[model samples]
Target chain A: MVRRDEFVLNVELSAEPGEVIVLLGPNGAGKSTLLEVLAGVLRPDTGRISVAGVLLDDTARRLHVDKARRRVGFVVQDYLLFPHMNVVENVAFGLRARGMRREHAQSHAIAWLERMGLEGFERRKPRELSGGQAQRVALARSLIVDPRLLLLDEPLAALDAGSRPKVRAELRRHLESYPGCTIVVTHDPIEAMLLATRVVVLESGEIVQDGTPSELARHPRTEYVARLVGLNLLRGTASGTVVEVGPHAVVAVAREVSGAVYVAFPPHAVTISTDRPVGSARNVWPGRVTDVEAHGDLVRLTIDGTVPMLADVTPVAVADLGLGPGSDVWASVKASEVTVYPA
Target chain B: MTHRRPHDWRVPPVILVPALVGLGLLLLPMAGLLWRAPWARFPDLLISESVVTALRLSVMTATAATALSLLGGVPLAWILARSRLPGLTVVRGLVTVPLVLPPVIGGVALLMAFGRRGVVGSWLDQLFGVSIPFTTVAVVLAQTFVAMPFLVVAVEGALRTADHRYDDIAATLGASPWLIFRRVTLPAVAPGILAGAVLCWARALGEFGATITFAGSFPGTTRTLPLEAYVAIGAGDIDTAVVLSVLMIGISVTILIALRGRWMRAT
Candidate 1:
């Protein structure tokens, strides 16, 4: 477990064995710094880190464990392989360093290489391997040490398009088999969803959202999170106990607000109407059709109007409304659909 | 891009003249020596007993010098290149002194420091009944003093330019400093070290001033090829001197060829 709080990052996480927790965030979000702090490559300005229930680093108490004794496997953005050593020797390094004899170390390395699906690459140097192959060799070398924790920094980001899917699948299989707490750092939503049991979204060195992928997609507290969850987020003012998005759109919320605020709604909330409807929801707009995308079992429509709204209506509704490029559409939403929060 | 010249016209008079001049400056001496060869007496002059003994001593002492450089200079380069100790820059400068120091003056400096009445030399003599001056050991010492710096500087530069993340990787793999140095650092710089060793050996074989100043001219004990040539020149034996020079040049050229084939292919 690692926790850091300085500038903007204030994260507290305790990962159990066999759990893959991915730290996901955009660039400059301090995701790499968090991983570095956890891997003992960087020291936190103020934090406490414990691994296997042992207090590894407690900056408040001036306690810090050296990286060499951290027993954590780290894979950086670029696979930092020793070019001089062949695959077998590179894998055998950790064992030899821990006082294993050359023959025994080599045997263990061979076994791990075989596990990584690199059986016959023992004699090849790091320069001879492709990106994915090098990543696998790096994984084999790191795992052969049997570290207590595993840290991967954008492991699949360095791969090309043709190699990405295959390598990601291979890495997923390896992560499943690794019986240790693994923390993978990445900002790609698909990668986080595919590889992580739980996702921690960091922004400007702070954990803004931490939850299961489904949960975060449904409820996001920040615009960054909303964008990541693919929600059309908007901000507006409130008047007369009603949050007014604009002249044509206003929603009565549970809270009585008198000033500026933020309102977020999932794309599925809006209902496309050919004409304005008589309703208590008090939100209506004749919008210009801006964008259209096919979601699972639904067609997502983006319309520019008094308040630009993304509506996830069924394809049947799309066809019924005759919605296509350059057509007028009325989008209406109930007050309850808008999640109004103080800005 | 920097010069803004067309690729086809890149080697115009502005570049070609200087390039040819530089090549000529480097090759003109070897050309002159070959042109002035006394080809008729070369075999007889080269086959003399003194010539043979000097050649053997040159091989022996130069090899010993190279061995000494590898044993001591590699670690020195590592320390200078990697360590952050105080006075490090000063130490690095001192290591390269032999490269710029006049060879004769360097020999005199060696004599002043390790001579019979010199500080360390007197104690060594008194404590162990050992004297190092004007002997085969002295010849080796003189050669090493001048040649070891080349190896150290070359290796230190290589080490400084090496990828340091390999050290971090090794550390995470449970490798302590010594193991990393032996398994990673040493092997990574092996080619540079080898190149330096070859250059050091060649320099030692051709060393003239230091050998004569520190280790005086003596047959079978101190007379390496250069000292033998100097002695032959003094005795009006120009043919023998030329033969020794040619032999030394030949040995150094062979080493260059072998190393070029072995390691320089990477460049």
Candidate 2:
């Protein structure tokens, strides 16, 4: 348990060796706080934290290990590379602090930096490097220490949009090569999906959902997760092939689920028409166009009606339908497209 | 697009006139000192035994005082800047009392605390037969008492402004607090410490009231350059006094120039 201000975070978390778990959450969701606790920078009020079977913190017994001895490497959001030290000196800091010879530490740090594709930049200061370069140096600094557990908070959030994808891929490769369990915190769903072997969704200081990327994409448990995965989710009571969601009935491919359940379908699966859609579709509702946004090649239209939903149509289709905010429209989804799962 | 030239900017006479007057007021004394200096016997007077001894003593004690201040002031500054303890504002105000307190009053306070028959001084005398007044040690103590506040204030400001996240980063990198302070905090705040030390040294070199009261002026013992100049003036040796004043002005100008950027911004 950790109480900061009026926010209280009580979570029980564990990771196996070689598992890359991404803590996915929005800002102020206690993602960074969790990392700080794991790194021993902030002691939890009451908990038992043991890394690799070595007891690091047990508030019950008043056994809290000092942060310096926790052996947990944390890469902060801003990649706080020491402004005073050169790249090599910053990377070698941990080794030097642990009593290793300066020459030995430098050689080791150089090897690590070279592996990170940062050769000949040893003499450069942090300010001299680009955002991506500084991030790599921060990573090398933490990884060279060979910590038992690694925590990265928004590892690629500092990069420019053009460089984020490249750095994210490179970070993924580095995380895979590390032998220890790694927990990455990020608000970007795409980043979480790309990096995490398992994703834990946190909201309001609680874990709302924990599953693999595909599992979450297929059956998101909450509206936040559904929105993050670009799906329309509706909670309702289900019986056989139909679920009564809000004021509208959604038909799904035959499933054995009953009682409280969630109905989900991709935005692409939703079709919109200026007039009522006529098809074999089992679910249809008339709604006014609430919002229209250009999403890559498709224009996503948010329709508000008996069953509020989002539909993705091409720009040409949007032109034909004359879709804009306040335009009356009908949204339909085929029974096969709707997925039903227990709430 | 056209750009404004540097000369396009102007300072209004309302502000510029008095600013110039203030500058002139400050420079007039140095000009008078230089004009009245004994250039003819300057070499003879500069190398005199008393002048040399006093100069040596001033430099030695000022440096010793600066060093002592650094030893105790840095940690005190860290606590003042970072500690979350209650009443720290009061403690910080108390630490700066010496900066505003008259040096003679500070000298009297020091006498009450460390002089023979004084609080700590009486105990030391009873146990070890040690006496501090009228000695070189007393001169250093008095100088440190008056000058250390400068170092502490400067360092505390620097620490307060420095990025504290770096300490957390160092800790996560497996650095003990002592190691972090030695390798990271110390290096990061070095410029502040250097500037503070310079100020402390300058103040100590000019210290007179506290030294004269707490440590009596004795040639070759505690009679620093300032005391020597005072003695010269008391004996009506106007030429020697002028020479000493010119020397001090030269030293002060050199320090001001060396620390112009940091000192100006600090003030």
**Which candidate should be chosen as best, given DockQ against the real structure?**
2
TM-score of 2: 0.94
Q: Give the clashing pairs for model 1.
A: A9-A205
> In model 2 chain B, where is the ten-residue run with the lowest total lDDT?
B258-267
Q: Residue-wise lDDT of candidate 2 within A3-57, one digit each (tens)?
A: 9999988788888999999999878889999999999889999899999999999
DockQ of candidate 1 against the true complex: 0.56
Give the true-contact fraction for every prediction, in order.
0.68, 0.85
Off by over 4 Å in 1: A1-13, A42-47, A58-64, A120-128, A233-262, A266-343, B1-11, B14-21, B117-119, B264-267
* Cα displacement (Å) at residue A232, model 2: 1.2
B93-183 per-residue lDDT for model 2 (tens digits)? 9999999999999999989999998999999999999999999999999999999999999999999888888998899888988999988
Question: Model 2 off-target regions past 4 Å?
Answer: A248-256, B7-9, B260-267
